[model samples]
Target: MHLVPLIECAGKGFPDGFYEFKNCDSFKLLKEAREKQFVSYLNIGATWKPWHLYRSTLPFTPMSSPFHKLYGHLSDPVRIFTISGEFTGHRIPLSEDLLNARMVMEAKLHNLPEQVDRQYSSTSQSTASTTSLINIVDPETKDEVQFNDPDFRNGIVTCAALSLDGHHVALGFGSGVVELADIDHQHTISRFQLDPPNHPVWIEFVHGSHRVAAEDSEGNVTILSHDMTAANLGNLPSGPLPAVTRVSDNGLFIIRVPRNTDSSWYDSLTLVSILGDPHLQHLAPPSSNNFTPTSNPPILASEPSTSSSASIKSDAVLTIPHRRTLGFSPGAHYIGAFDGLSAFTWSTSSGELISSYRVTDFNLWIMNPAVPFTCSYRIPDPVSPRPTLSLTEGEAAHTHYSETHAGHNLDSSWIKCPFYVLLPSEEEWDELTMLDIHSSAAGRTPLFGTNGKRQRLPVSFNGKLEFIIPKEYEPVVFSGAKGLGAWYGDRVPFDPTFLYSPRSSKDGTRILLQGWQTAPIVVDLSQVI
Candidate 1:
């Protein structure tokens, strides 16, 4: 494997810099295997989230089988679920052995009906003490704990969700049961049932608040309030939305509802706020968890002369239109939605919308049927400081529970929600244009620099249709961000480079292309330099 940098300049002069290429040790081996046979198709779950899980199912022959003809007839599809909820992508293989069974589900999509439960047992191993909840540590922070609560010991936990803060988790089971488990406890702290048993597709807990919301199989969304200091509210009157039909992603109180089954869903995200004063219709602040009044007794006072007084109420504040998907900028000021692969930004507080940026062909594309399109965002670094704060605030700040917490700086951080689907573009499709050997446009490319200046690269792709970067952009190989950008477009099918943004602070700086599964041999970038 060769690691070469490209510095190409045309109109002016070649920029003086180094193009670093990081090579993964296993690239060449994996490439040969992929060419020979389809070992497996791996997909990254969430690009920007701390907990990055990669799903891959490989078909392989089993060693043992009862029926002679069935032996070779059946192929087991194994899934590799990597736990990167933390920074480092530490992987643990979840197969029959880890789950103490012969097989796990092949796909991550939980929409499959409840009948699939009977095929697998949640409590198969003899040494297991419990049937459902499995506790695991965050791969990045060894001290952080993660809980995987399987509903009903069944094959599917449809509405399982982890809070943005990684402190709480909620799960809607196959049996129409909804349960909330505290990450700190690693056990179910509260449980409830939706009157009619329906599968819950997804759930989202307010980042820093006690309230948690969930969506059922029938498209109904219900929000529940939890008592502070672990007080049992028992069962409170739940606020339900009748017309949602289906819910995709849920932020503090915001959610995405598809307009219909078709590819073109609503292009706006919904924001629901439960208020303290129901009748006033005016939003009331959620009770603060950290507030503790002094025990000093006060003298009773006579009733005020006023005729009307404040009343307690709960209400829902929603963002006007339904969006395909909603995401918060690194700084909470900007909320975004994707309309047909094009991303639009909005001021969460002022409702002021920003111009849309298109990532369609670059990030979204239609490939062969076998190679389905997968999209996800890269979670920023949690510890890295944000660049600057925004001036305006969205209504979401006033109505969302995450906003009520003192420790959580909801105003400073953003949540990335990525959407991926198979739909044709409205714009005219452009066919691949093969550039001539001496084409001037060949070297006309954007250069990424640490100082934010455009410098000419000393090299180019020579003229290959595409380039393939390494799985993780390692420091030893990549010299600057521009080299990573050039490596991205040059890489043929996919960019193996994984980018990371700081979690709390907002900045545009992202990690570049790291390394590849195969070393550069026949199509090396040495000539351009």
Candidate 2:
């Protein structure tokens, strides 16, 4: 496998830098993620405030499974219930794990229907917890937490996250204040401050664990207790301190984005203990982890481990081109990222670059069924695993969650949700090109030998699935007109700066797509996928 720096891959004259300063003083993405905590603050669009604010990528969360795991066969939409309330438009979830937890306190009478009690049984399946939130709040919920000034006051809310139970909300203020508030009672439960005034830019309640991972403005993470306090067990470390970090959906791992000393763009992605320093476990021995002779300007491993809370000591590093999105396959079997037209996958067990593939076809935006088109597109579902005799095993269609029963052998295989989908950037915005994730990334291919071959592919570099906006509802640039109304046979125009804005259902059956200037619509993936 031969890889080069993203800049070298681009040839001459690449423009723009990767780093940007995101502050709470004007960021709306943080504000929107917290709006549900304070129902009244969920503003839909641009406000009339004199000062303009940075519009956030909308907080459109896909619904998790609400039914018992036994009913895994139900179609994606049927297996769940919407977060019944003002957030209906956002399509939140009732969340299965929450249903199994004991009732903290008797739910408000209005929120829980009386009929639910009669339906409950010790031997029967669980639905009481789910029923307790039906029509929980008005579609137009009453205002609660109001900002001093909509422009900047609201922006002071640096970041927000909801507990797995969806009963608590943790908000980080610009003043380095972290508040843990109860969503059910609309009141503050606890508040704390970070030393030396570090502002949190992102916060997430780690699922399946009693920890809160807060990434500060400078990209340093502080692990807090479930009650929002400095705690004993900390996060698994992934980067040298001060590297930008992103947590997984399951909150089990962290991926660190450390910038290349040579360039402004990040040349590699280090998954912190999940993407860290001394306390973190670094992959042992350079010989154990091997990188295929890919990537131009061969990266030299930088070590001499530093000792800091945010520092990491890595023995093996798989440096690739500039990457943005990071994901893990189920059980974190494989880790990879999309850098430009290339896809790179690594083995978690060996910490080696197992396979890499570059897309040969660029115009893979439409889906044709009679006989599938694009090499990236994985059409027609097979009933069972069929044998295939192809050498390009690295470039097969990725395994969609719906297909594998999401890892059938695993316990609770019916409802596993891993963050593995990839959305590459493109010039057009009306359509979404999905570099879908596969379940297994366990394959091997010989190095670029003299057998006359192209680059080696990932254990799996399945093609792609592309869906466009229904012709009836195209995205508008200004006053909502369809495709710039051209008679010269021009193609439909799109918002080039899509900012990775689409949302997919937990089951991977439906992807909700809403353009900047258009109403929301869903791509029914059940048919094609």
Model 1: how far residue 436 lies from native, Å: 28
Q: Give all candidates' CA lDDT scores.
A: 0.28, 0.31
Model 2 spans with C-alpha error above 4 angstroms: 1-155, 162-168, 182-190, 227-246, 258-268, 273-324, 347-352, 359-529
- Taking the tens digit of each residue's C-alpha lDDT, what string does model 2 give over 336-372? 4433234444444344553443422312211111121
Pick by TM-score: which candidate is best? 2
Decoy 1 TM-score against native: 0.34
Tell me, what's the RMSD of every candidate?
23.1, 23.2
Model 1: per-residue lDDT, tens digit, 204-280?
A: 56434355666565655566555632212122111122112111123433434332212222232344433332110
Give the C-alpha miss distance for residue 280 in model 2, angstroms. Answer: 4.1
